[model samples]
Target chain A: MDYGEADRILTLLTREMGRISARAPGARRSQKRFAGRLDRFALVAVRLSGPPHRLTLLEAELEEPFLGLRDRLESSAAAAYVVEVSAALSPEGEAQPRIFGLVLEALAHLAEADGPPSPDLLRAFELKALDAAGLMPALDACAACGGPLAGEGIGFSPAGGGAVCPDHAAADPAASPLSPADVHHLRALARAPLGEPRADVGRAAHRRQASALRTFLDAQLGRRPRSAAFLEQVMET
Target chain B: MAEADPIRRLIHQLSRLPGVGEKTATRLAFHLLRADRAICLDLARALEEVSAQVGLCGRCANLAAIDPCPTCRDERRTDDTICVVERPQDQWALERAPEYRGRFHVLHGALDPLSGIGPEQLQIASLLHRLAPAAVREVILATNPTVEGEATALYLARLLKPLGVKVTRIAQGVALGSEIEYADQGTLSRALAHRHDFG
Candidate 1:
């Protein structure tokens, strides 16, 4: 975010420190200090001073600019959504090597992907990020009863934090019906490596999975990410 | 009450401006107090006139006192070209150079997905509508050199190219009077990639 005058308030998702906001004074005007390295999706090695919560960005060296992400609108939008979600999932002033790796892998995949990025790529990132945060929805068994999930009448509940069987579905009004096929797809997405393509599913199945992920994210984050709306707009166009 | 005091109220209002702290606001208030009464009254009148009259131009979305704005209504400017910028300030900066005599379109902001700004949030539809007249032969995207600005330019180019109208982006290179040794890597790389035969 742009701060007072030429300063910038940067939200950096670092491998060592997780997510941190540092004040980059004169970042907007002086490229000498920042060397034009503080752009979105650009990995940088930064030097900082001051206290932990109030760190001042002294200098930054651009490592991976991820320049290919700027080639297509879809790629850029996807990269934006991924970065925003990763920053949200990461805690402040803590090491989150897994989440950081997930984000970096996702960005690299998006940048190097041949065509329009698959929806599955983002789904995989979300699953991995949730897992890193210890909030991955239970898929193997019923979240409430911890029993085996039934083939029929299965629903995913954001509140319950996993797949709910028909017996527990009625208790949570917020639970959305999850078809067996959708569950299988979600499981596959959770297991698939980031950027790896999965079996192409029907549009309806994709919509359902997207909604489930959105609801789960909203429940966890207390609100939907702002970039998610932008992603939708970009994808629609 | 402290809120009821005129001097305190003036200081508070001044502090609301960007980059002005309370201490600076206090200094400004006292400076105005010692200034000529005519200057203070003129400043007040200017502020009131701006607040009451200034608004976005309906055609181009640039801030102006008139609906189509003076530039849009000017006959001297050609209808063959329209220069698009991210803000009114950018348009003003381009206007400082007298070489170009063309109309302008201001999107008000660049695409910033993280900030929730998208194509719908900008004045893109209006720009497309303006292009439908077939009078515009070319559109020059003059957004900033930032990543968001570059994305906005790319998006606009994709949308505008199919209309059969020519779309071009402003060139990026090292600034005039700046030493190449002192230039940043990004600027130097862009300059090298876009180098042309010297006259």
Candidate 2:
């Protein structure tokens, strides 16, 4: 959005900068200056000046406009969801090469998706983001009891940080019921490489995985990512 | 002390406005102090009246003093063609040309998901409401030619196309009198994409 008449405040997540907000004056009206390079979700290389607390964008070179995601609603929504999550996970003024790479890769997949980007793509990003943020829960074992989570009727507890066996699940108040399929999907999401194609899961199972990850991510962040609501709406359709 | 206190308060308030740094605010404050007392009082009254009286138009969501703004109520305007803008300022920009003689719908903002602004946050529902009763045949999306603006236009196109109404995007091209060499690549590309045949 525009901060002043001609200037704009851009929130960008960069590999070296982590998350930064820079001011680009005359970005809105000046065709020769930034030259439409400051659009959202477009990867660009920028030269910045000013103090560490406040940076002014001096120049920008458009590297990837990601035009495919910009035109489609579902793809745009997916990009938004991933960007929001990346912003939430990244701390300002710190370099996070892994998270940045994750976001760039996810956005690439989203741009190319014939339909809405696979829920697996977002889930994988989330799981990796949690790891990068040092919040990777014990997916293999019970989060609370540290026991094996090896059976049907398991539950995933966001409050406790991961899946729990029925024993600890019964004790945890915030545990959401997870079917065997949901657990398998979550594990695959955490383990699969970016753009990995696994067997297609049922819609019900997909929704369950998304809901569980959303809850877990919200618990870690202390608030649901605002983009998650729109992402949910887009995915529902 | 009383006079100094008021002056200090004025500078503080003025500095809060966008683009008004403390130095500029102080300069404005001193200027106002040196100017006629009537000017200061008149400025204060104008601000108060604007806040007290001005409100959004019920139909178009544009800032106005009346329930339905004059533009909304203007019988001369055609309901069949509605120009959609992201903000009231954008609507004014289009009206400056004086060529578009249609009613306006202000979205108040664009569909920026990263900022948590979605269809619900904007005046999309009200737009649909306006379309339901009105003889709206064409919706001219005059949103700024930015990424968010394009996404917003595309989103609206998808939403409004189903209603069987014609949705059109304003043509983007090099500004009049500007050299083609100075035009940005994106603008030039779009201009070429939407090129028209010469008479």
Candidate 1 deviant stretches above 4 angstroms: A29-31, A170-172, B188-199
Q: Residue-wise lDDT of candidate 1 within A127-155, one digit each (tens)?
A: 88899998999888889998877677788
Quality of candidate 2's docking, in CAPRI categories?
acceptable
> What tens digits encode model 2's per-residue C-alpha lDDT throughout A135-203?
986678888888878777678898888889988888887887787667767777778788899888877
For candidate 2, the per-residue lDDT at A120 reads 79
Q: In order, what fnat does every candidate score? A: 0.62, 0.60
Error of 2 at B50 (Å): 2.0
Clashing pairs in 1: none
Best-fitting candidate, scored by TM-score: 1
